[model samples]
Target: MRKQPPTYSPQMTRMAFAASFAFAITAPAHAQSTVTLYGIIDEGVNYTSNVQTSAGHGHNLYSISSGILSGSRWGLRGVEDLGGGMKAVFVLENGFDVTNGKLGQGSLEFGRQAYVGLSTPFGAVMMGRQYDPVVDYVHPLMPSALFSGSIGAHPADLDNLNNANRINNSVKYRSANYGGFSGEGLYSFGGTPGSVGTNQIWSVGFGYSSGPLNLGAGYLVARNPNVSFFGTAVGATAASNNFGSSPVINGYASAQSQRIFGAGATYAIGRATLGAIYSNTQFRHLSGAISPLNPAGVEGTATFNSIEADFQYQFTPALSLGVAYNYTAGNNANDAKYHQGSIGADYAVSKRTDFYLIGVLQHASGIDSTGHAARAALNGLTPSASNQQAAVRIAIRHKF
Candidate 1:
């Protein structure tokens, strides 16, 4: 007993259908997934004093440096919805030499980060090349992380602490925030065939942030890193330590080991955040590593303990200033001690662009002729004899 529907002309029906199709084509998409593209470009000029001189010629070296102000990198990040409060995420980041368009050292591709993982209420677990727990949980409380300067890195970046960098073949697990406290732990497999124990690393760390105070602590270990041989390269090469120059251990010996323990904290005062950190590194079983001096199984051990303090001040809504100091002592074959201080100012030109100026001074005491030199040829700089060295840098950065 339904009433008859109103009739329409064929042309009218076609027009109505066309209108609906146009509205669908032009409507905003609300349920579609999203992918974000982002990157940071940081570059600057560096001036180093006390550079090694070749013979009687006194030459001044001045050059542009990338990652001096900050690490230049580009990355892609995305998340896919899986329903039930669960999701999949991935990050692919690459570090590069802005000055010469080269990949970061030791990272073939996607060197900075390449990981895929799942996130749930229990916490997030990730695999395939990631930052260790020390770097993730401990580095943020250091002056190097506060200031845009290169002097903050420890010698050889020996420990993953201070955010000195990342690792490969890693399986990492991070806990969700719990009452202003959280933690993470990681293990990296050497992945060598028939030699499962070589070149492996493991770490665990925790952090807490509540109100105006933040704190973190961590531990790390690396075993049996490989060292290859290069003929006649007596001093520190642009690639690695000059230990290859020795005849007894022609290349690096197997089973070079490292261990680290570190802790840090930050306190918010007014518009400023004050931060401090301390780290200890122990190198063991460093035998058979061909060094220019220690050619035959030099078994001397090295210990590094460092303390750093820093402050950040918000000058304006768009500008900020930071100052920091770091002192480090090593009880090793060289008995090296270093003092570093830095000051920086950053101005936001826009939401995604910024300009910055930074200055740093470094002084080393107890560096012997056989010890690691101050100018160890980092970031492609030629290796020079260990002498006192200092540097200053300024840069601009953009993120999107």
Candidate 2:
């Protein structure tokens, strides 16, 4: 004998279809993509001794400053799962001055970073304005970035160790971590209709980290640095790339080509850590452009060599102290030497909040890029009329 399967009624069939639809909607909800908002707020007050005054003399200056330890910024980050072990990611960050509520990075929105990319098992490829290789790899091992912040950077930050600038119209590649080693590369387009190489920038870097040791090295090259970095600026007008009138390398802004190479290492032993860094920057085919540092027009090549050593001790789980020394020398258009020292202490109020105090002192000698007597200038502070300058800061930072 044969048996026949039972058939469902119309009402039962409709109910089965509805049940399946409900399950489908609920099943994927757990795996849905996510978006997150985050930000950091850093505020500080500073006092500098021997700031140059309008009367061409040294005077003390007191003011409120922002981003003493870390730049105040907010951003949005998002990720979407695409299945097949792949995902899409994007980030948009904005830098701002906390004191006067002004925009940082030349008053442009999303100035700090803006990029979108796909993350695969192999690596990631992104496109947008972004940090170059030096900043991504080598800068992390430098004391200026790890501990002392902007005040401890190499003279003028000529090596880009502090990430003073970001590349625009860039395509970047970051490799997947391979047994504590990783690498990155970046290329920025000039965006000129007739010229493919003009105003272009390229960089590459590698990093390794295992246990308590970290090492990094990188190289960067930029063509028509001034025209590319600062947008369109006519004769003698300072643009976005110009830090101000006081930095040591301000005169080299008109360089047709700029090159930078740097390497750094950090070792941690127990509660103490030691770090060292070396960098070389070269400005080639300089244009005879008028600038605050080169009123008489700079013609010829220039180079700067910088070295830094630093140490940090974690006295307690919540407290740490750091000290660093920097030496920099320049040649060609300007012959100058700078010696700087910095010390700082940070007390963790919580995992996301901290209070810090830092002090820096610097001295300069020889002839400046302007062909005048070299003046001492602490990073992010005014140049002193004499050859000695000092600054101190107290700040509070919070992250979310």
Runs in model 1 lying further than 4 Å from the true structure: 1-32, 53-59, 162-164, 227-255, 288-297, 368-386
For residue 34, give model 2's deviation from the true position in Å: 1.7
Q: Mind giving the per-residue lDDT tens digits that candidate 1 earns over 1-400? A: 9999999999999999999998775552343334678888887777765455656222345778777556788888877767786778889988888888988745457877889899888789888767777777777776666674555555444454544346677888999999988999888887669987776778899999999998989998877543211111123232354332211122223337667898999998888888888888766665645554343344556567878788899878889999888776766543666676778888999998888887666566564224333333222233334434455667788887
TM-score of each: 0.81, 0.89
Q: lDDT per prediction?
A: 0.66, 0.85
Worst 10 residues of 1 by lDDT: 227-236
| Candidate 1: residue 251 lDDT (0-100) | 24
In candidate 1, position 50 carries an lDDT of 47
